[model samples]
Target: MKRLALSALVALGLLAAAPAAWAHTELIGSDPANGASLPQPPTRLTLTFSEPVPAESATVTVTAPDGTAWTVGEVSASGATLAVPVTPGASPAGQYVVSWQVESLDGDFVSGKTTFTLAGAPPAPPAVTTSAAPATSAPPAATSSSVTPTGTAGPVATTSSTAGAVPAEEGGFPVWGWVVGALVVVAAGVALALRLRGRSG
Candidate 1:
């Protein structure tokens, strides 16, 4: 009984520490906005996040409606913003999807997709006009600290619990937990029965 009590206390301590290191990187915001219809294709693609991300290892891919690859330049990060330059070209009026695989500071790989639309065909110039909005947002750009390592897992799964908490990937505790709980109940019942018989005798 003492051993089991100690084990339960140790498990509770582990559960308390789970929340701090169990964060996942996610797409907090984007430029041109998802499903937004712009007058023309933007000069670049910008993705913003809630935390500082590694810039050097991020991969941003922009594909036009016509299935042509429109990413011309490299991905750059200055602060919490990450931007990729778009190739100069005319795109038919339709939706374009931006897909990215970025490495976070915790050495995890994060990836997501967002879409934007062009109201009309792209203009001839690749240069940004005075009337043209900035390709990126005001928060400054973000990037990975080092080159993204290959084979990193995709987005992470997070779970919160005051008791036993296991990641969704490895799966929650197996059927054994229920069996052990049942045994504990039976033991308590036997103990109560002995106490009643002693009182009657």
Candidate 2:
């Protein structure tokens, strides 16, 4: 009778411990809860689990609709909650998926995913304006004067403007020839006077 009682107590104790050993950590709730919609993106993602999680073994990834990563740094934990920093500038107005894996106190890793949507479209990118360059005008062509040639060969002669100048007739003797004849007449008169004086003496 005593042996049968001891076996029954041992069976009851094993049955009670089995459930606790088989249980694993599970996600309970999240901030920006699943299927939530917001006008703007959240700065951080918070996840709650059934038990405490370790920061070193927890992993969280936040991805945008276009497959761009939005998570910034390593995962952080506070008891049963985990917080992940998110980059709001990189996240546009679209659906975002959060995938998380955490190591529970029972040495089991639990993973799940949640999604949220942003309501309106993203703001338009800034406009790009280009300035037009100023136009340049070309310089004017140089002017040249034409020269008409005279028939003379070596060099063209120029007229002088001296006082008491004599102008030559079309067909006449030059002034220099008249002056030479007057000089010869005076010389002949002198020679005749000298010869008369000698004869009279």
Candidate 3:
């Protein structure tokens, strides 16, 4: 009976340690490469992970050196790939940070950041084309104003919470939370079973 009790304690100890063994979703690959220099920004940023990720509740933020966000579009997912559209902008020759938070297959949230640099001077904003119309020629600014953007840009989500509720993207405990809970339940069942067996013996 004493030997069985020691074995039960050892089993419980191992069970408690099991949750620590799991790690969060890792970034397997990325387009334009992490910490790389690019002359021109890519149309889309793609991130591939070790496993397929869910599409909903994923966010990517690309902030320029001047404290301006260049992520002009929404995030889309296809298979293991997560793609975000970036608008054309003059990113000065300096380091830029891209941080992202995503959900893994196990319903756990993971986040990471990478930095990349832009070399060479940014090109001057495109010159305004003039037409034969006197009204068009007089107002270069008016011609620029006529060009309406495709869609209404949505507000960017920042890490802030009000009323004591955690944001979905930034909140949530690690995957180990569920793993630890399950292990604790299993340990309790094993302990009960061992106690019953020892009494019968």
> Against the unseen true structure, what C-alpha lDDT does each candidate score?
0.80, 0.85, 0.79
Any residue pairs clashing in model 2, and if so which? Answer: none
User: Can you write out model 3's per-residue Cα lDDT over 1-201, one digit (the tens) per residue?
Assistant: 999999999999999877654656788889868989998666788888877777678888888888788855888888888988888576677788888889876678999988888887757999999777654445445432233356847544445357876445447776667889999999999999999999999
Question: Across residues 91-145, which tens digit of lDDT does each residue of candidate 2 receive?
Answer: 5678988898988667988899999998887679999999889888789778654
TM-score for each candidate, following the candidate numbering: 0.51, 0.57, 0.49
Q: Candidate 3, overall lDDT?
A: 0.79
Candidate 2 TM-score over all chains jointly: 0.57
Model 3: residue 182 alpha-carbon error in angstroms: 99
lDDT of 1 at 1: 100
Alpha-carbon runs more than 4 Å astray in model 2:
122-201
Q: Which of 1 and 2 is ahead in lDDT?
A: 2
Candidate 1 lDDT, 113-201, residue by residue in tens: 99988886545888765786768758957853444456866544444476776534355666777789999999999999999999999
Q: What is the descending lDDT order?
A: 2, 1, 3
Q: Which candidate leads in TM-score? A: 2
Best by lDDT: 2
What stretches of model 1 exceed 4 Å from their correct place? 1-14, 121-201
